[model samples]
Target: MSLTRKRKKELKRLRSGAEDLWTQQQEVLANANALAAEARKQAAYYTREEIAPRVRGGYDQYVRPAADTAKATAGRYVGQARERVVTDVIPAVGTAVGTALSVVDHARAARSAAFAGEFKKAGKELTKKTKAATQNSGPGAGSVIAIGLGIIAAVGLLYAVWQTFRADDELWVADEEPAAPASGTTQQ
Candidate 1:
C-alpha cells in the first residue's frame, strides 16, 4: 500500500532516464531529417547533371534522325515546320521539364525546412509556457505523491480498525451433527 524510500528513489531515477531517452530521440530525429534533406539535394543534382544529359543524347541520336527523314519525305513548307518543332520545340520542352523538376525539388526542400523551423519554434514556446505555468501552479509532484500516500494510509488504518472491532460470529460453519465418536469416547 506504500512505497519504500528505495522504491521512490528508483521511480525518480527511472523518470529521469526516460526524459533523457526522449531528448536523445528528438536529437536523432532532427539529425535524420537533415540527412534526408541532404540526400534529396544530392539526388536532384545527380539527376540534372548526369541523367538528363544522357537522356538528351539518346533522344538526339535515336529520335532526331528519324524526325529529319520524316521531314524530308514531306513537302518543303511541312518539312520546315517539322524542322522547327524538332530543332526548337522538343529541346525546349525537355529543358522546361528539367527546370520544372528542379523547381519542384527546391520548393519541397524549402517547405520542409520551413516546417521544421516552425515546429522547433513552437516546441520552444510551449516549453517556456509550461515552465512558467508550473512555476505559478500549486501542488507539485511531491505534494501530489504525499497526498496519495496519506489517502492510502488512511484507508489502511480504517480497514485495520474495522477488522479489529468487528464480530465474526457468522463466519464459522460446523457439521450438522458431529461425526460418531470413537468407540471409547464419551459424548458431551
Candidate 2:
C-alpha cells in the first residue's frame, strides 16, 4: 500500500532474477569451455606444415608491406631532418647573430644617450656656478660688505655718544622744584 513497501518488493524480485541469470551464464560458460577443448583436440591432428604456409603467406601479403612502408617513411624523415639541419639551422645561426648585434647596438645607443644627458647636466651646473661666482664676486665680497657696514655703524654710534658727552655741563643738571603735599603717597 506504501511506496517504500512497493520499492522493496521490486528490489527483491530483481535480485532473484539476477541470481537466475547468473546461474544460466555459468552453465553457458561451462558448455563453451567443453566445446573449446573438443575443438583443440581436433586441431591437434593437423601438422605444422599445413598451418605454416598459410601463416607465412598472410605475413607476406599484409605484414611485409606494412614493414616496408614504415621503413620508407623513416628514411624520408631522416632525409628531411638532414636537409632541415643544413638549410634552416645554419641560416638561423646567422640570424641569431644579427639579432644579438642589433641588441648590442641598442645598448650602445642607450649608453650614448645617457652620457649626453649627463654631459648636458654637468654643463648646466657649471654654467650656474660660474654665473653665481661672477655676479657675487665670491664669498670674500660678502664678508667685506658685512664688515664695512659693522664698522660704519660702530663709528656713527661712537660719534653720537661723543657729541652728547661734549655738550655744555648745564644740560646735565636737573632742575629742582618744590614738592607738593601728598595724600599718604610720594612720587614713585
Candidate 3:
C-alpha cells in the first residue's frame, strides 16, 4: 500500500494543532506558578519586616512608658532593700554575733576562775546573797505572798459586793463569846 499526499498533509496539520494547545497550556501554567511564587515572597516580606513593625508599635505606644516607670521604681526599691540589708540587718547580725562571742568568753573566764580557786571573793559575795535570799524568801515566799494576797483580795471583793447589795437596816454578825457547857445536864 502507498500513502496519499493529502492524508499526510492532514495528519501533519492535526499534530501541529495538538502541539499548539500543549504549548499554550505550558505557558499559562508557568506564568501562574511564577505569579504564585512572587505573591508568597511578597506576603512573607510584608508580614516579617514591613507590616510587622507597624503593628508591633501598639506595645511601644500604649504599654512601654508604664512598663519603664515600673522597672525604674523596682530598681530603686531593690537598691533601697540592699542598703537596708547592708546597714540595719548587717549591724544587727554583727551585734548579735559579738554578744554571743562575749557571752562565751565570759563563761569561759568564770569557769577558769572557779577552777583555779580565784573566785573566793565572788563566792563569798554570792554566798551572802544566797543566805540573805533564803532567809528573806524562805521556801516559797513569793508564792505564799501571792496566794495570801489573792485570798485577801477575794474576801475584800466579796465583802464589798455584799455591803453594796445588803439592806441598810440589817446587820450580819457573829458573837465572839460562847456559853460554857453544863457539868451535868438532863433532859426528859
Candidate 4:
C-alpha cells in the first residue's frame, strides 16, 4: 500500500513514542532491580543482627531450661521405675515363686510321710497353718457389696449432675416450632 504524507508523519510520531516508552520501561526495571538488591541486603543485616540474637536468647532463656527440666523429670521417673523393679517387683515375684515351689515340695513330702504313718501329727499342724493363712482380716462380703453400691451411687450422682449442668444444644427442648422455609425453596 502507498502511504499518504499525513499517514507517514503519524507513523514517525508513533515510532518515537514507542521508543520513549521502551526507554522508560528499561529505567523502571533497573530501579526495581536496585531496590530489590538493597532490600535483600537489609534483610540479611536484620536477620544477622536482630533476629538471630533474639532467637538465640529465646532458646537459651526459655527452651533450654524447659528442656532440662523435662529431661530431669523423665530421668527421675525412669530411675524410680528401675528402683521399684529391682527392689519391690523382683523380690515379690521371687518370694511368690519360692513359696509356691516350697508348698509343692512340702505337700509331696507330707504324702510320702503319710505313707509311713507319720502324717497324723503333721496333718493337724498343716490344717492349723492352712486355717490361719486362709482367715484374712480384710473386708467381708457385705462390706464389699456396700462399697460397690456406694461407688455406683456416687457414679450415678455424678452422671445426674453432669446431665443437669452440661451444655448440649441437641438435648435442649425448643419452646417453639421452627420457622418454615421460604416459599421459593423445596425440600428434597
* Model number with the top TM-score: 4
**The candidate that achieves the highest lDDT relative to the unseen native structure:** 4
Please list the C-alpha lDDT of all candidates, in the order they appear. Answer: 0.76, 0.73, 0.75, 0.80
Model 2 residue 26 distance off true place after TM-score fit, in angstroms: 18
Ten-residue region with minimum lDDT total, candidate 2:
136-145
Error of 1 at 62 (Å): 1.0
User: Residue 185 of candidate 2: its Cα lDDT?
Assistant: 66
lDDT of 3 by residue, 1-188 (tens): 86699999999999999999999999999999999999999999889998888877977987898899999999999999999888776665565455446556555665676788879754655565455446633434334545566799999999999989988854757567777878696887
> What is residue 3's positional error in candidate 4, in angstroms?
3.4
What is the Å distance of residue 110 in model 3 from its true position? 1.3
* lDDT digits (tens) for residues 57-94 of candidate 4: 99999999999999999999999999988887666556
Mind giving the per-residue lDDT tens digits that candidate 1 earns over 1-188?
Answer: 99999999999999999999999999999999999999999999999999999999999999999999878777787878999888876675665455446556555655565577876655555565456446645754444545666799999999999999898887878669978877986789
lDDT of 2 by residue, 68-183 (tens): 99999999999999998788765655554554465565556555655778766555555554564466444443345455667999999999999987868776777888798678
In model 2, which regions exceed 4 Å deviation?
Answer: 1-38, 44-49, 112-188
The collision pairs in model 3 are none
RMSD (CA, Å), candidate 1 to true, equals 42.4
